[model samples]
Target: MTEFGYFLSSEEHGPQALIEQARMAEQAGFTSLWISDHFHPWTAEQGQSPFVWSVIGALSEAVSLPVQTAVTCPTRRIHPVVTAQAAATSSVMLDGRFRLGVGSGEALNESVLGDEWPEAAVRLEMLEEAVQIMRRLFRGEQVSHRGRHFTVQNARLYTLPGEPVPIDVSAFGPQAAEIAGRIGDGFITMAPVPEAIERFRRSGGGTKPVAAGLKVCWALDRDEAVQTAHRLWASEQLPGELSQILPTPRHIEQANELVTPERVAEHITCGSDADAHAAALREYVDAGFDTVYVNQIGPDQQGFFDFYRTKVLPQLNGA
Candidate 1:
């Protein structure tokens, strides 16, 4: 059976609100949880970006569900050494239920430090080094090294759990998926396209778990949901990070003019019905993902989870 879960938006909700939702999600019968880790919201309209590590700490006490970073980048905004410490601490707090999902991040988060965004090749190189450093740290070993991307000076994780946290990679296209197969303990992705899965396995992913996420707007009123999603998150539907540095929400509003609600609506599902929600997520499972995470956009948090619990999940998971 395919595992079902929810992805909380840290950029849209505060840690307290998210903890409440996570508790509710577990009560609603979801088996796992994924949380966004972002330094910025990319647009003011999206509103909030809580420190995810702190939120996860609180969530550890609040829910029974296992949690993972939907994805974080250890290479850019935060060095691998710091990320290693954070992951080790979080793993201990979760009592060995944490999965660290990492990726080569976008400029929206990383470029804020005023460093040049390296090409994909360089980022992959940095990611490999970062993962190596994390493994060494997680072993509670003193690591002192000089690598092209990082230099760790005798760092060790003193607070790790009994087992090392599983590291999942967020892969997009072929090359990255192959790298994930070669290095990652598992794989996380948003794209449900079957070609991506085949690429991952062909490149050496083996029988490890594959997790995917899909964004939707769950509202009893479909029109209101779409409008709200477009108003707040349409910038994400655009191809790149040009709007992230534009300084204000109005700048994002202007850049969004080149794109339309129709474009955003095409990629996202918005409806008051449970069948629509199930159909949307079934695409991911049908494509062979071992686990699927549904992320709801806009507010109506209780209504969204309630609808999925009563209507969507049962149909998909055949409860």
Candidate 2:
């Protein structure tokens, strides 16, 4: 069965609010959770970026649902060895209910550490090496690595879950999809693109779970929802590689000036039409995603949960 999950927006909500949201999501029938790891929000209007590891620690205490980092970049801002330790501890805290989702990363989060952003190919190379190092550490073995991108000496994870933590790789195109297939336990992507899914499968992803996420706004007023989504998530509409390459929230906000409310309405599912929300989710399901996560764009998280419990999730479960 395809599992429905909640996408926790670390960029938009405070840590306590996110913990509450996770509890609410489980009550509302969300089977899992996808949390973003970021140093900053995509736009300043969204206005919050708490340390994701701290929040994950809190989530373990507050919710029973399985959690995964929607995608964390282990190559740049933090070293892969450190990431391995964090992921290992998180698995223990969650009692082996954690998966690590990794990717090449965005400049919005990584550039904050004052490192020059590498090209996509170079980043992918770094990510591959990082994944290898992490996998070794997860095995409870001392690791020594001298690679083209990173170095590690006698690194080991003291704490580990009973089972090895699964790594889900995020990809936007075929090349990354192939890499995910070769190295990842699962695959993650934002869009419901069949070609990408097929590429992953053909490249060796096989029957492993594929996950996708969507953003919506649930409100009584459709126009108000649109405005809220545009105000808080217009940066999402910036085209091409901008989402990955842009270095700061301010830069994202400047580029998002071209994203009008109408555009936001056209893309993001907004308003309280349960059928509309279900249809939006169905796209990812139809594309063969085994896991789908929905992120509410603004602050009506409670209302969204209630709506999903009453009107949306039932239909999706039935479907």
Candidate 3:
């Protein structure tokens, strides 16, 4: 069965709010959780970005649902060795209910440490090496690596869960999907693109679970929902490579000037209709995604959760 999950927006919420959301999501019948890891929000209007590891630590105590980083960039800002250790500890804390989701990363979060942003191709290379190193560390063995992008000497993870934590790799295109197939336990993406899924399966993804996420604004007033989505998530409407290349929240805010409320509504599902929300989620399910995570775009998380629990999820689950 395809599992429905909740996407916790670290960029828009503090740690406590996220913990509460996790609890409520579980109560609302969300079977799993996906949380974004970012050093900074996409735009200043979105506001808060908390330390993801700290939040995950709290989540271990608050929620019973399995959790995964929607996507974390282990290639930059933080070294892969440290990421491996953190993920291992999280797995332990969650009693083996954690998965590590990683990707090539964006300049918005990765460049904050004053490192020059590499090209996409170079970033992929770094990610491959980082994944290799992390996999070794997860095996509870000392690791020594001298690679093109990073190095480690006698690094080991002592606090690991009983089972190895699965690594889910995020990809938007054919090349990254192929890499995910070869190295990842699962695959993650934002869009429900069949071509990407085909590439992943053909390249080596095989029977691994494929996950996707979408954001919606759920409110009684459709117009108000549209405004909320545009105000808080207009950065999402920025086209092409801008989402990947923009280095700061301010840069995203400037680019998002071109994104209007109409455009945001067109791209993101908004408004109060339960059938519409279910239909939006169905697109991902119909695309053969084994997991679909839905995120509510604004502060009215309770309203969204209650709607999904009482009206949306029952229909989807029964279907």
Cα RMSDs, all models: 2.0, 0.8, 0.8
Model 3 TM-score relative to the real fold: 0.99
lDDT by residue (216-314, candidate 2, tens digit) is 999999999999999999987888899999888888988998899999999999999999999999998889899899999888889999999999999
Candidate 1 error regions (>4 Å) = 240-254
Model 3 CA deviation exceeding 4 Å by range: none
TM-scores, all models, native as reference: 0.95, 0.98, 0.99
Candidate 1 total steric clashes: 1
- Lowest lDDT 10-mer window, candidate 1? 240-249
Q: Mind giving the per-residue lDDT tens digits that candidate 1 earns over 1-319?
A: 7889989998788888899999888988889999999877757778889999999999899997899998899998899989988988898888899999999887777777888888787888889899999988888889998999788887887888898878999988677899998889998888888888887887788888899998899887888888977887887676644643454455666788777778877888987877877888888878999889888898788998888888888887652
The better candidate by TM-score, 1 or 2, is: 2
After aligning candidate 1 to the native by TM-score, how far in Å is the CA of 20 from where it should be? Answer: 1.0
Encode model 3's per-residue lDDT on 1-319: one tens digit a residue.
7789999999999999999999999999999999999999998888899999999999999999899998999988999999999999999999999999999999999998899999888999999999999999999989999989998999988999998889999999778999998999999999978888888888889998999999999999999999999999998888888989999899999999999998998989999898999899888888999999999999999999999999999989943
